[model samples]
Target: MNVAHFEGAGAPPRKRPWTAPGALVVRALGNAAAAAPVEGAMLRFGRGRPGDPGKPVDVTVGVDDTKVSRQHGLLVHRSGWWHLSNTGRLPIEVGNHVLQPNGDAVPLRAGVTSALISTADRRHLVELCVNGSEGASPAPAFGLHTAPGHVWRLDERERLVLAVLGQEYLRNNPRAQPLARHQAAAQLAELRPGEDWDVRKMDRVVEAVRLRLSGQGVFGLVQSDLPQPIGNLLSHNLLTELAVTTSSLTSADLMRLEGAD
Candidate 1:
């Protein structure tokens, strides 16, 4: 008598190892609700399925969308920041930066950042949130004081331009986003009918502010610091820094714009 044995079913499937001290949380925004804490060095995202060739993505972004490639993009943890890299045919919108296929990875700031994948008919969004380590010390507030020289310096005209461009942020709006140049220009024209305020003038004023801040050791204010198709990245970064670190733009300034409207 003899016993029959299975040909190749001896061992269990190998489980993916979980890295200690999770660093990031990735959540897909849509009908498909998939959320996971990234405990490893990288988190892959795409429309891939299990048992596919090569390494499959960790998260399914556009499950039902045929346009989304199987291995669309990935988030890599490096140097205390999460960098997003797009490897799909279409571009991925991260904040104001559009990550083209095979482009350089863009480092995401702390807090929640929305990444969008757009198709002809619909849009897919993924939310990435980098968590600070438990018991970690608060970040130092360098040059974030109310002292005269410590705060960012802006002339009257420059302040007005930034006030208009960053009104939403100054209002503490949770959904605040940087305003377009045209919108800011139109608002400025209303605020100061005598002074000529067009897109070109607004561009110059903002550029001057950025140059000044960049000289002060502020990064991401210059074009070279950001990826191509910058969109509103400069404005977003500038406004966020101004809103949190300096009194260059305030609620009174926003009220001035509101009073005009």
Candidate 2:
């Protein structure tokens, strides 16, 4: 008996994510879904009731989402990445946390993305995507604060996760955006050894941390008001509420990361 094998049947290299310039995409994440601004230029989103006289914005939202203001949000391409800023009377959520009208900007990634913003009445689910991360890094924010009664701490992998989140991919780097699961897994894999962690466990890691924070009586997760992804909520809380920036892992934690303990 004989068997035939292809000489070049080896696994091909993983293809890198590439992006086109001046491209940003947005989609609705709620019951009724849609995309706006196309994905090529700067655009604005607004709403007009059935009888409102003003011209519709770049993306004319239907009267269904009354929460969307006349000029709800903006999509801008700056520095090296696409930025989403809320310019309406209400907050524009990019993920776990809502972006205040005058709040820090959140960088958009590629493909379909979901954000929850609200109006005087209800919340709206919207999505914005970019071609890819394209090496986009957020401005790093590192801080440590301790009071007589309140204190925050980070474990080993959490430190690494925050480090990846704080990476500066955008010029105006606002707050640290949570890393994608694969990105977090890759970054965590580099930081620690001996405990082979898989990307599959990223949610567990983040959720555990979230539950721990909840145990500490932290209400930051409620900011979104909607039960959503844990990682985004946790990252937003850590950066905005707890200020967990930089690699907070100390020598002891570093020992665990190096598996020298």
Clash totals for all models, in order? 0, 5
lDDT of each: 0.68, 0.49
> What digit string (tens of lDDT, one per residue) describes model 2 on residues 1-261?
010111121211222211232244344421121122233345555564222466434444434765678767776655555667887877665654458887666665345456666666676655454543342212223565453444457765665554444343111244446557687677676666556766766657666666777676655544342232333654555544433322232334434444632
lDDT of 1 by residue, 1-261 (tens): 011111221211122111113245565632121122333366677887433678576556788898998888877765555678998988998865568899888886555577899999988887665544442113336778665634676788888898889888898874467887788898889879889889999999888889888998777888877556677778888997787556667888778768874
Clashing pairs in 1: none
Residue 113, candidate 2: Cα error in Å is: 2.3
Say which candidate scores most in lDDT: 1
The C-alpha stretches of model 2 lying farther than 4 A from their native spots are: 1-22, 29-40, 49-55, 133-261
Q: TM-score per candidate, in order?
A: 0.50, 0.39
State the lDDT at 120 in candidate 2. Answer: 67
Q: Name the top TM-score candidate.
A: 1
lDDT of 1 at 64: 87
